[model samples]
Target: MKRRTKIVVLGSALLLTAGAASAATASEAPSPRGAAVSEAPRPHEAAAPETDRPREAAALTGTAKLHRSAGDDITFSFDAHLAAKDKADPMKATGTFAFSHYQNGDGARAEVAVDCLLTGGKVAVVSGIVTESDLPGVEGKRVGVTVHDLGRHDRLGYSWAATGTPAEMDGLPKCVSSAPFEKVAKGTGDFTVVPWQPEF
Candidate 1:
């Protein structure tokens, strides 16, 4: 069954790769009780025309954990090292990414809203131009900007930027491929993500 899930997922990814050309929409993946995974933007924010500050999506409200095993040789634990498993922001100037296959993200949604180029965990000042990639196949490709934390640091969060802000930040660089992720999920399973893995 596990292998089959892999096969199914990989097949879907390939199809989605080409299908993404005109995919136009995203699907909603349900989560445990309070948190719900979403492929589309909220009615209000989605309604807004442009991407602005790093606002938490109402669709995004919950706790998360990213970890590695004690016996493992890897460095960070799920809480300290989670992959930005899936990312999409209508805020993105180009394309929308649908996140699937998230593994240990218990009780929280696996996506967030950030300027395609901007990637900051918390922001001190909005002075520099943080760069980031944009959602593809759209009006703007991936410009650069900065992601400012909502000022509430007790709860962890992320912001997007098109350019790089040289401020003091804790968020790891976005790992679009084989690098270690920084979110937590529900399990003892090791999270090994590649550019092609569905998520989870």
Candidate 2:
């Protein structure tokens, strides 16, 4: 009976030791399947890099010259030199103006178009409408002219509206040449140019 008692006590101690070890192992192990998970970042919540920010439009000021063709169906070809109002870069422009009379005899309208080459090897095509008042007078009067881009695939787009005067050279009753002429008028204006976002 003493021997049986000794065996029983030994068995109880062994069982308790096993139970404590099992409890410790379970506490150290990872959690079961259904615990909460951390969320991934959303697109809107992320911050944009500094280089990805959009560029602001630039203000520009410059000069222009128009050599006009005489007679009823007149043609005015022009060249413009422009500098950014706040920057050191310059732009060059060359284009033509063709006039058409209104059927109602009110006045005349001119279709104007020009190719503007900017400093950084970019090209923009500008076009707009003009009136007789926009032309340089024989007395060298300043006139207002406005033009916008023709949707060319340029990063920088341009639109300008400014006043300028003409400087006519002494000659005969003639029309403006298709090429640059000696007897040309001078013009100047101010406007803004904007840049488009870059494609990835």
Candidate 3:
């Protein structure tokens, strides 16, 4: 064949091959825009099993002792003066704590509280309050913690109410970045007294 004729034949062959490949791609289903939808596994591995949930926590010894003065016209030895930047806090008063298996993810919490009777613009009588609950994987044991309602005066009142465990403080302080005395400038810098920790 002539040189020019050979060149024409080669180009035609290339075009035919390209056309066939395009036709094949067009016949396939188009993938949606997001992650490829993969079916859940047979056992479904995302949500934790209902039975896997931890049982209530067991009772333990806990305390909340403050080492500073707050402006509440009521200062107790353990009356917490915290200033939480995140989550709803319920420390309405002040004192020590030791609680377990908190319920009401954002409503109720586990804790122990204590304070002295208000006297001379300060609390003078030390008393205690405790919240009780059970721990997961543990039975016949009741855990408690002392709590103060710091959220009483909050305009945005408590929103972050979760349980905590003293063993590891599972998800307590880390829920928000703060100390026990984030509210009281007088004692905030020098004092520290918290109420509870999330369960394990």
Judging by lDDT, tell me the better candidate of 1 and 3.
Answer: 3
lDDT of 2 by residue, 1-200 (tens): 13211110100001011123342333335556886764655998766876787333222122222223321221222233333332333223333333222212222333333323232112222332232332233222112223232122112111211111122323311112111112223231112234322223
| Candidate 2, pairs of clashing residues | 64-187, 68-176, 69-175, 69-176, 70-175, 167-185
Better of 2 and 3 by TM-score: 2
Q: Residue 126 deviation, candidate 2, in Å?
A: 9.7
Q: What's model 3's TM-score?
A: 0.17
**lDDT tens digits by residue: candidate 3, 3-107:** 221110100001011123342343535556785874555766555876887432211111222222321121112232322221123332243433111112211
Tens-place lDDT per residue, model 1, 1-200, is 23322110110011022223553566655666875553566688664444654332211111223232422111111111112323343222222221212223211111122232223333111111222212222122211112122322112212222121112233433322111223233342232211211213
* Runs in model 3 lying further than 4 Å from the true structure: 1-108, 111-131, 134-165, 168-180, 184-200
Model 2, global lDDT: 0.26
TM-score of 2: 0.21
RMSD of 1: 21.8
